[model samples]
Target: MSSTQVLNHSPFRLEGDFISQLLTNIRTRSISWTSFVKAGCLSNENMSVLKSITSVNDQEDPLSRVDVLIKDIPTYSKVLFDSILELSNNNTKNLDLTKILLVILYDGLTYINSELFESTITDEFFKISKGNPYPPFIEILNSTTSNSNNDDENNQDNFIISILTAHILTSLLTTVPAQQPASSLDLVSLLFKYIQINLITSNKLQYRFLGIQLLKELLSIKSFRNIYISHTEYLDSLINIMLDKNIELQMRYLSIYCLWTLTFDSKTSQLLTTNAKYSEIIPSMFKFANDAVKEKVVRLSISILINFLNTSINSTNKNEIIKKFLLTNGLTIIKNLIERKWSDDELKEDLNSLYELLNDSIKSLTNFDEYENEIKTKHLLWSPCHKNTEFWYDNIDKFKENNWKLLKSLVSLLSDSSIGDSNLTQLYINQSIICYDLSMIIKVAPEVIKIINTMGTKTQIMTLMNSPNSNVKYEALRTTQLLVANSL
Candidate 1:
């Protein structure tokens, strides 16, 4: 335990007070001067000499040393495991005792890697993400094959890196562990249980991503459908996490994605219609879709709408929710993205998601007509932002400003999915008519009207009034005018 003992021993030295000291310090939010280059020298085999002092007997528990490491960091076992990774990688190209050590070390590391394979540090993961730099598997596929000289013979480690988690479980089937069908559903049940017990209810971000990625994989399975469906309240807990609070973009991004996956879930979608617990969660799905940086959110919105539409096709509750989404003219917003003149990478990606959604929406409208009491939705004629522009007036801000005009262009383009749907009038009426069907509660729903009226102000409102597809702005203007008109 002395400094001489620590310095004189090889990486195989056990009871090196050096590592034991630094780990004790890390918990206080300060890292010690001891480095990975220094710590990488400790040997797991030598550490096996550690003992349980409570026994007072002359015997030692073989795992007592490693147990101390894990007990000290039950929350961040991954960080402890990482020390082994640094050591193994340093000796990967050594081709001698080092290679032998790397091989022996690989099996235990593999086991640790497998068990924690798809787990996460929840939302704080984004902080870990920005500090630690590593590209995802898909990005690596587009580049060269060899990423490192580690256990992989042909850059297979590159293939193993997942954006969701660096998942590495497999059966030599070339399929990642979680993707191999119902067999991995146990993985689903297990991870969700850990997440529910820990990260789901926490204010912390660490390990929050583990839950997000695991749930995402679960949804991909048809068998685990009931698992998520029955846990409606828990899923809602996951959904309602506030976005602005998450400083980590990727974690926030994954949380939004998890909600999207939940809403699109067939059973989860049906349950929301009947379960009182989920009505808030179900409608709130639009929060992500309505945000400013919304390509991921919009795509998920389309999925939520599609699931809701399909559930409606089979049952009821179509009017209460479906009508708002369809009329929010969110569909038209995406369509315009596709038809617009811009050709940037970000725009193209967003446009692709928009097209895919419109494609699915058209399919739903076409195929769901067999149901009774089907309220026919219409085609879209996006009224440009100017006109009798009265809605703009209520929205506030200068119409002449370039930013205001640019906002109009971004949401108004037509998409590929918009190309063939013939019910333009029906879709337009759905937004203009059904959405405002809340006309009776306009006084009570001031917040609703304010959100709808956010884009422009009074002068623009007059411009929107005389605008070509003026009905929406006009209807809104008439509704506002009617309150005082009726008061007199």
Candidate 2:
């Protein structure tokens, strides 16, 4: 059959018939195939089987043909890779040929043994040309539109190529060495960009799932994980995918699974707990676990939260993470999850462990611990401690601990500009509460005015004093009056 005839069939038909035709053509004329056979990479029996399949209609079992090819997958992958490069370099937009080559490569890799896979695919496949911004595969990926209509052949072809490429690359990374040279970094960046454009942004569930799967694979390497965490935009994109209510349950589960893998590294866990943008992961996981209908989704989300809570480098960091979880009503979520009957005994065990951890955290917290937690989380509000006069009196001296750690956090919150719009009322309440607490601190211990002044807390309060909101303006005015009255 002509390549065009092969291209015209359905994908399932294409898989068997198309591969049979391509292998026959390669065996007869391809230099890569000639070299592999000359090197005796394939046994005589396998070679005889390959030699027999000259026609697409050959009655050889498809699994038998696959077994023969997988035994020498490196040679087959190289041949397919060269074909793809040639087609791409010629600017041949034969979507059928490209998709077929990618599908064969993808399937070959999928079926190959792990040992052979690791040995066959390496950094050489991932190299980028210094003259060109993207590798050829990436160029094709960028050239395609992500139209969702299946009737659009070109778009569908592009989508298939993308998914296959993602799967193929993920498999290739299994044996590809980590900490590659700087030249290959462009490929990493381009791959991430492609995923963001095609997979993460695509409406198709298959695309999103493969995208996250590819992400998980990329993150398996330490170097790639570092690069990933350094780019907060991508990190935020990942978190958004996990939190998207419109996303399917499996996709969300995969996204959290990616996170669960990431938190295995201490530095990543630290960033998740500390970075304002990434820290939203805590609340997102809690909410997902609370609402997820699938047992595995809830299990994975809780596992991630537990990782965050347990992976802290210090007690202060641990406490801050625990406090953030509790502030988001994580305790309530955990309790509820504990009440549900889970088929997985491990999940039930995890729920019980998480509930105990949160309870222990709560039991150990003094009023001051609660107040400090609120300050550190930048989520201040009129909890009882904020309104209690005696609480402030007792804790005013403790703010000096850790060189005024709690006080510094409060000042930092006062200066923050990126507080999101979704919580505008809460923002107002938080700022108002901070102002009230600062005034009470000034009243209880006038000496803290020096520390507050040096940190420019006064200026931020003055800015708040001009607010149009009556409560914020009033609280800011009250705090400013105290600062002035207590001035040294």
Candidate 3:
């Protein structure tokens, strides 16, 4: 019933080989150079079957027909994955190539066998890896422009390059082993550089489509999210393009996708507020998503707000409400160290470090003294229920419930990550948490006294303040005096 569960089911639904065959067929025709491409493996018998269903010519409808053929793909490639990339390099100039690439990247993802997916077909289209001449798709597109007239070729060149880049990225997502960060990081880095340079310099409506491709690819990595944050300028271009009237919906959707990736990175959360352009830009997100762009942009905005909320320790009351909703809904990931799968001590040790980190994070959050009261009351959040809520105190129970669950989720992450820690390490980690807690208590103690009138006068306090550690007591006394003076 949840949105992710519902959304995930469809993407992973198609059969592996069937999807592969579709991808292969598309690739074969995608290249304008390849006259050798066949109708499809089953085209001889199914030619009539395919023709009746599609209303256009063989070339025009291949991409669209393939889309239809895929609903039943599970029947074919659910056994026949080899067929996906079997198409030759001729798939170079296909106009609708972008469509098929997205289809494979989206649907074929679920069925791909990691070993076969990676070893057989990954760089075949782009030819990037040196071992096999897996040159990137960019090179392939650039090659097309060589023999063409400059005037006529420009738009088509932009189209082909953008489409190819999109497909290349789609292939990466569809095939890359989701679990391996180390193997994937290098390619992701290369992709970020490609997208940044190509999309930024061109400013062409069609070229902006690469923004979506890059966003989807980068998000899949999850580990190298930092790379996204460091490149703030590229991100600004996306926010700007999202609103450009001349920009196509294709590119706008792509820009929206890019915005969602920005949400996952912590650094950019602040950039949304600190960067002057973002003040108005961020608000416009609500208007941008309607029935059309709604699912992508709306979910993206929620995800972005959650990132900002998660990073805030002393954020306003409204922040608490937002953070609470996100946590309750399982939007944030709590790091965990589940050991059911393996007994390796090394693995356990790594998990322990992860646990320590969770504790440190939780403690930091617990002790967060907070933010300005006025701002807490002023900032507003749009609610999925209807109009956005202007005041969080109006929904205190929801906030408290979410806060409680947030702590519980931290416990889960810690438990999952605690596999290797010996008692000593855990004890040491716990000590750090205790120290952090002391700091938190120290921060709020004076405020507590001011509210309760619990503190005695300084002279009365000094009479009883005989301590071995005079310096410690002196500091405490000085702190209390400052609190009292400020209260007055």
Candidate 4:
């Protein structure tokens, strides 16, 4: 059995309510303001402010008092901030209060005096040491734990505090200049982990929603775009969320919104064109735009597609992207979208622009260009040109260019094992198309058979002859027969 299968049967698996139960247990515990004052973590005046906010007799909402504290006595923000740092240092005895203090800090920072608080918080929160690469709050998050049940509880408490601290830092980072923190640390990876842990690992919808919101906010910062673009794993994670059928509609919309934000950067847009892995996003966006019932989701999907075309670094990249789009029937989808009565003017404008762009691309694309792009993308289908005798006769020699680059791509596609069982139909179609194309090439130029056999294309074709799909087996047999006849 695989390691994943073993892990699935592990006895120490987390319960569905793990985070919920942790929060409930933490909330049941309380801390007195007097303890903080005595420890010098909170000044007497700061303690007074806390008392007023938590006062039982006060008719006003505590949040209102928090707003007043930050506005009238901006120094109180520092007092609360300092108390949090101090309490976090002795976290074993003060974890509960540190969480409460972090809540207050998050609220206060929303109305923070940028002149007084920005530089100070930025320096303190991101302060690094030779011993540790993470910030202090992230240090708490990285704390190690064993399998002991008691230690698990302690670890859970630390995790709760770390998440709260991350939120507070997020609030501060959004308001201040993001470049300093972004450059100082691997902020992209850190934020990606934050989102992944909450959204993917946890079962709670609220946490998942909050994760998407955090991603949206961070992507709004331009400094982080290049770093984000470089990590295909990060992009893949967001794309999975956006494409997941089980995810909430709003969450998926927000996830795509994050992708839209990244496309505003030219480098990310170009990466989508050149990288095969990232290029898969083009078809996904097209399908989502075609199927989504929500106007906002459709609007954002179209907007991202427009950005991809507009931001393409050069004509080659632009045409590559456009070909992928067309392979997914993007032009038909755009035409239907343009005919709809969209209430959003911006959506209408985007639809028209995308329509024109796709039309222009269609005018410039040759039959061979489309065929070559399909091979490059490895997304084979029986397009009209695939069976056209004229197309095969005209383009058979073109595949030999660049030292038979197109034929090599075909061989690679036939050899791919990554297509999962769920896509058996697609796998069969792709295999059939490749076998038929190889047979056509062998018939047109028998001399290329020596080259094709050396490239192991025959081995892949012979394997496909055992497939359950009749079409695949038939095409594979026909191709193998051609190879045999030509070799003799």
Output the number of the TM-score-best candidate. 4
TM-score of each: 0.37, 0.66, 0.40, 0.78
Question: Considering lDDT, which of the candidate structures 1 and 3 is the better prediction for this target?
Answer: 3
For candidate 4, the C-alpha RMSD (Å) to the true structure equals: 9.2
Worst 10 residues of 1 by lDDT: 366-375
lDDT of 1 by residue, 305-371 (tens): 5567665645346544443444344566556555645435654665566456545655454111211
lDDT of each: 0.40, 0.66, 0.41, 0.67
Worst-scoring 10-residue span by lDDT in model 2: 5-14
Off by over 4 Å in 4: 1-48, 56-76, 91-93, 107-151, 178-209, 420-424
Instruction: Give the C-alpha miss distance for residue 302 in model 4, angstroms.
Output: 2.0
Candidate 4 — which pairs collide? none
In model 1, which runs have C-alpha deviations exceeding 4 angstroms? 1-187, 207-210, 217-219, 242-247, 273-287, 292-294, 313-321, 326-488
Off by over 4 Å in 3: 1-59, 63-162, 179-186, 200-203, 245-254, 286-297, 316-488
Question: What would the per-residue lDDT of candidate 3 be over residues 244-328, giving only the tens digit for each residue?
Answer: 7776665666566667666655556666644434544434543443224334444454345445555553556334434332222
**Models ranked on TM-score:** 4, 2, 3, 1
Indicate the TM-score of model 3.
Answer: 0.40
TM-score of 2: 0.66
For candidate 4, report its TM-score. Answer: 0.78
